[model samples]
Target: MTATVAAPDKTRRLVFPFTAIVGQAEMKLALLLNVIDPKIGGVMIMGDRGTGKSTTIRALADLLPEIDVVAGDPFNSDPQDPELMSDEIREQIAQDLPITITQKKVPMVDLPLGATEDRVCGTIDIEKALSEGVKAFEPGLLAKANRGILYVDEVNLLDDHLVDVLLDSAASGWNTVEREGISIRHPARFVLVGSGNPEEGELRPQLLDRFGMHAEIHTVKEPNLRVQIVEQRAAFDQEPQLFSQKYQQEQIELQEQLIQAQKVLPEVYLDYELRLKISQVCSELDVDGLRGDIVTNRAAKALAAFEYRAVVTVDDIRRVITLCLRHRLRKDPLESIDSGYKVQKVFDRVFGLES
Candidate 1:
């Protein structure tokens, strides 16, 4: 009898298409909205382990178009956006040196659980300093993720100090490193995506409020849908290249839609009536800070951009309330209602179901 050998896994051959993912419509929408307008801050996705949380992030990264960057730039600074460039980088350009320009995939940096402060924010280059007696800086995960996405899986399990570092950078868009009397500051702006299971632990309120949107995903409960998901996974495992090829058209269409949304985003307008409505909704929910009101308005405008609409409609505001307000809700120990439910109730009362 001949022994059957298993085929080698070709997971590297292709990534699962963003458009091909099954279910989790809300999660997908939240991600896409941020992609269209990164000023929405970022998104936190909470759910079960096997419910495509990490996969959704990888697929979204793949779905995005490549970005043009200055060659050999550690921060991936945009050639067009000088404000985001480092002082060293600016000096090179000032000398009339020919900067090599190239296109690369948008960075998707993962902050592992055991990552140290030095590893994350980078430390001085000891080798260079020892060899030449010169002070030199080393780039870290935060620098690599500039103008891209920084993803943290199982974020709630991370150490509080590290979480504080991430939150500070996310809030200020600048990562300042001071060591041995030397200081370096650079642009650290990037979209933050955090995912974890709620049962494991809870995120700090201060860190949680930094995210512009929050989404909860769950396992597919329908038998037919589960079967379909399983079958698709099996097929992809068997022939990764072939499966990706099948979804090529769909992926292209989705990418085109994202590009269109970005172009249309600036044109989309938020009217006075809708602004009043957003304020009322936030007031009714009794959310603590003004972040809720600001995020809600940004989310509504993003939805309008995605739909290629120049005006914000009531439906657009309604669609984004839960995503924007879920994490910002005040904790009520005596009331065991879902945050999304509270948002919906307030939304219905303020806008009316007919509106």
Candidate 2:
């Protein structure tokens, strides 16, 4: 699953290392699990502004190992996997033509707030197609994000319709564009990561529920930890290369760990009793749909895999259940209780853990 790409340009800017991030453990854990199993859907991170949300996500994308892609293909087409290939690549395969393979860093696409339907989903040149007798298609952000990560900052502020389009593509692993009866479909299997400041606004419950996991973060309050984070940032800014070098080994180790976890994920399993308990907790929480149950199960298994285990443990479920179910619980304007706390209380009761 890992590929080796050409050496990075020395002049390129260095990202803050993921392993070097100060705190926000919950956010980091949710992001890692999603990477391990994109089928778990994606993670919605709600936090205060300047809480390292964007920093951590960018570091994660930089942390991931390179991937194999078809040379000259805009979609990062996986030459060997049809599910991740573009229509043009499939046709080339059908003709039994040779494919040129290349390696590149996993793409990380930032979805802007003002992005239009055509900007995100690409456009079809109907006139060009009709006149030239060919498919005149321009690839979009979704195409560039294929087999990579699609990041939406301030997702809560994004238009609901745009959010729907992103979620639909994330879930279905494909994007279709139709214009003047000319249709084009391409693979768009990417981990959808969205981060926002809760103070701004909240996404519709329906759209929020579609995200696989939700991580809530706050500004670091500990003086020592805050000082350390600030110092680290200052150091990185002063000597980017030297600072990055200090944590290069840890980054490499984490990259290897993520790759191993992804490979081990398919073998990881959750017990039947645990499955029932997960559902029971969801039932008690009155979650609107089965998404909470499904995401919890998937995230627990992913955690087990991350730890190099084939069987899920209570600790695994305990760690991820809140992130998986917190946003799914119905909201009450008059109730001030934290949704995560409510989820934990229900989990402990259903799993027979002492409160």
* Model 2 agreement with the true structure over 219-240: per-residue lDDT tens digits: 9999999999999999999998
Score residue 205 of candidate 2 by CA lDDT. 93
Q: What is the alpha-carbon lDDT for the whole of candidate 1?
A: 0.87
Q: What lDDT tens digits, residue by residue, belong to model 1 across residues 129-203?
A: 768887688889999999888999999999989988887887678899987666788889888899999999889
lDDT of 2 at 79: 78
TM-score list, all predictions: 0.93, 0.97
lDDT for 260 (candidate 1): 95
**Evaluated with lDDT, which candidate comes out highest?**
2
For model 2, which pairs clash?
A: none
Give lDDT: candidate 1, residue 286: 81
Model 1: ten consecutive residues of lowest lDDT: 1-10
Q: State residue 337's C-alpha deviation in candidate 1, in Å.
A: 1.8
In model 1, what lDDT does residue 308 have?
A: 84
Runs with alpha carbons beyond 4 Å of true place in candidate 2? 1-10
Candidate-wise lDDT, in order: 0.87, 0.92
Model 2's alpha-carbon lDDT is: 0.92
